[model samples]
Target: MSRVRQILDMNAFDAATGGDGAVKRRLDNLGAASVLFYREPIEMVAARGAWMEARDGTRYLDFYNNVPSVGHSHPEVVAAISAQVARLNTNTRYLVEIVDDYLEALKAKLPVDLSNVVMTCSGSEANDLAIRVARAVSGRHGLIVTDTAYHGNTALVTEASPSALRRSPLPDHVVTVPAPGEAAYGGEDIAGGLRAAVVAAMQTLEARGHGIAAFLADSIFSSDGIFADPAGFLQPAVKTVQAAGGLYIADEVQPGFGRTGDAFWGYERHGLAPDIVTMGKPMGNGFPMAGMAARPEHLAMFCEDVGYFNTFGGNPVAAAAGRAVLRVIAAEGLQENARRVGAHLKAGLAQIAAGSDRVTAVRGAGLFLGVDLGAQDGSGAPDADYTVQVIDRMRDARVLIGAAGQFGATLKVRPPLCLSMAEAERFLEAFAGAVSD
Candidate 1:
């Protein structure tokens, strides 16, 4: 058998459990279960620019992970981390120039008013802190989020997450709105659905006689389909949230820092400024660092009374790594690369879709894109079964991407911002072959 197939076959067995079906059986025993139920695994051993080498040394183009934003093992980021660790890697309690220096550089990227910063160990913690600050400032207990959004797997976050929200039970104070599909969720009326979802949330709140804390959402709904219809989709929703006594929180874990091409933040493409912005994933370029950026006043309540202090939140090593990433993004013009390379890939995919029946259309902005397959009625959505088969075939073709959508039907194509047009063409060739097969 071929190497990829061999690895796929091995995925059914639990290496630790020592038997076929053992992993599934054990997971079933746990009683809490929710997975797309795909049966292939890519055992990654090494990573470089825009690719991952399997344990068997098989190469594959990477287009489904946003965590390694700049590129895997970027020399500058690695060097900065190494140099910092050689001197110091202490906690937030200590006064350090690296911490403040890193803050200054990061704050420079945003609008001047969005100055104050607080660090967290991960995106989930960043989100949690954002929520706390918003609640403290606004003095509201209720929260809001779009349906099918995936913030994190934390207790509070998951309750706000529509991706896995219905799978479990939690507080009713979270006002849920539909993600803009324009057909599936609320067909042909993107503006109406967005407005309706927010309006319905307000109605729900009034019925319960409650107020809202914050409207938390990804600037780009990564877990859902890549783009949620037209530009400025979330502007109406943000206005509704604020009017309903809530603050707007833009979750930048996936689409922040110019990955979305046209704007620095995915939400900016939608034409609204968030009150709070939570960042993670590429913030430290896989250094386990995340942070929240807010206006000075929102932080004032928490900074004095609650007092934010994290053990390793803004440590010297993590701060240095972050500084390096910001520098590289500007110096290397990666955000512009995302624009050029993503446009090339989008054009190629559209050209191919015109010629083939396999792919229906390409959706999303910049490197953050989705490939939807043709349906029987000429609709673009590839059913979950076909999406699984396509992703499986692509993996066999030595390309590594993943499935998104409520049922895992959308082929997620968010590669690192450093991906070049040559690599994009290479990916398109492999993808074409996979579809033809």
Candidate 2:
């Protein structure tokens, strides 16, 4: 087996083909970077709502994807994309009403101070540009993020992403702080810990002659094992950055578009307004669309120094798709649905944990929940091996899920916002069976 395949559990690989011939053929053409899930990747044919259909006619309830936030192939979103593509699709240089409409609607959801929008093709591009804007505005190059954060895949961002730095060293201009979980729980002062971390990082950066430029964080801390609780815990960190003459950049790619259910944006839940917010994933409901929202004053510096223009960003087709998503969210009341269904799902998972010895901590807000799998010996250590086994078992039970956290021992349960109560029940039942068996 190749190195990547070796990293994945061989026992979990789907042996439906009874051989590695198919895998070998695909690997020969696509190369090693083609990362796939499971010991045996599912041959998916189609998806709708919260269910994905496999080539073998198996239907798996999807609790792993947030990209299709509204739902897979939603009729309205599809119609909008089809109509716009057929009618016209052009770059942002041309005058377009749809783009203007989307920008206005999106800005309306944000704070009035964030009046500027710069569209990009992906979350990576959005973060990359946001970094540039922060550097120009603050006139500094130092950046800080969570210890295990995964911001994006661009060269500049990949260096800033500590998770991506597993194989490589982080750039000198970047600093990392412990995630909120380490200090939030365990009877520690969450805000104080966060403030100290930022202060330490700023001191180091200043000593090296690179004053703090920005303190970037994924609102949900999705990569740092989903540390979201004790709402308003992030206020101290944000304030610390501002006091140090740095921008607070909120990475909303994972927790934006009402995924948290309590608020339209995750930062809103903490009641802390960010200087710059980057969004993607659910923006176009699976379409390649992303952008950053910023306060006019902060963006003014960047605009004056070096204006940006993307070729395909904010195009007519993307705008139409974005608009349709906004409409569907309101029409279907998916945000409230997430609140209700997420609560029900979390409660059910809690019930399951109450009876099991392996399941430990259950945390998250709205539709973004994480369940921790711990050692059976009562050591409180992450049991990543057990997590892998549970994932394989859930696949057998036709429930699609995945893992996260520094050790990959936490079950990452983020379904489409449109997930129904009945689907939630079905997943709970399947999960119970997977764990009990």
Candidate 3:
């Protein structure tokens, strides 16, 4: 079996080698906790639309960052944030019109049953709150996740994120099942196979004296190599978890907000009404904001035991930024754009895969796609080193991308939603050259 790769180690800079003055200054400041992308990290200065400009004046088409989901430095979002902060920036304690307005607009997009929304500064805090709410409502302590899932970075969330752990084993309260993919479950029936894995995991958790509180998963399985296909394949596993007295926490940090194209939320594509939904990263078009939506009763139950508050979670500035994102997504018709452009991009990638043995597979929905790299010897083994080479090649060609999956051999292709056809074609050309070389 291939060695499991940590999420942070994928295409990361080697701090030991020590970089130039700028890199050295960054390392000195952030130390070992710093996670910089690429072997030679680029000092990004500015970004707009689908491209980022390095401090050295080279412009690279960004196909890796999902945080700026709509586009980089979107004018509307920037204006809203600036306008709101200039007027007033306050927390949830006070009655703010924009804050409630944003919440109401956001709630309309969510399942009606999830009536209460709690905002947070990041996805990590949102997930941590969701887990607590699930445990409170389900009256259980165990959790289940996919083998290479990366939920968040909080102390509690890190324990559940298998891909984030480099040396420590998964805590007993946490159990992992294989990711929902053809590799784990043959193409015959992915739904049934994933359901069985969840069942087995629940059994194991029960045996360990920790009844399953929640079955948490990134709806698209982004970190587990983006296994999004057959649309409703997740329903069976989700239903099994709910029937087993466990809540389903949909971690939409990566795949939410119309990135999947077909639906506003990734869970919607799977036909799921998740018990709790936690979202961030793309919530505010690069603004630091995240939120958890749950049934009012669930939030009430959790609140009875402990109080939850965030000083800057849903401040007016974040609300303005979020509202702008929602408005831009609708006004610009970004969802439809994602669907159309994503299809074009996927087809181009499929052609590349057909021509190259090193390109093993192409899968995912909408703008969130994953391309698996393999050994060139026809054995089709996952090749991390070759993947890094391709990443560097793409970088040299002025295209930015990153790696994911258990072996770090899958290129995570997630450009902004505003990516034009010309940009998609440009990426394909760069990708073709990267792989061919």
Best by TM-score, which number? 3
* Winning candidate number (lDDT): 3
Q: Which ten residues in a row have the lowest lDDT in candidate 1?
A: 1-10
> TM-score of each candidate?
0.89, 0.94, 0.99
Pairs of residues clashing in candidate 1: 142-213, 182-187, 182-188, 183-187
Provide the lowest-lDDT 10-residue window in model 3.
Answer: 1-10
What are the lDDT scores of the predictions, listed in order?
Answer: 0.77, 0.86, 0.95
Ranking by TM-score: 3, 2, 1
Task: Put the candidates in lDDT order, highest first.
Answer: 3, 2, 1
Q: Which residue pairs come into collision in candidate 3?
A: none
The sequence of per-residue lDDT tens digits that candidate 3 reaches over residues 312-341 is: 999999999999999999999999999999
RMSD to the native, candidate 3? 0.7
lDDT of 3: 0.95
Q: State which candidate, 2 or 3, has the greater TM-score.
A: 3
Name the lDDT of candidate 1. Answer: 0.77
lDDT (10s digit) by residue, model 1, range 1-437: 11111111211223333223534554566534423223644556889888888777998888867888999989999999999999998998889999999999988877677899898879998998898898898787777776566787678777777665543554778777766765444546676677777777877866776677788888677776676448887788788878767899999988998898888778878888788889998998889999999999879977777778889899999999899999999998998898889889988888887877768767888889888764545555456656667777777877777766555566788999999888998989888877773
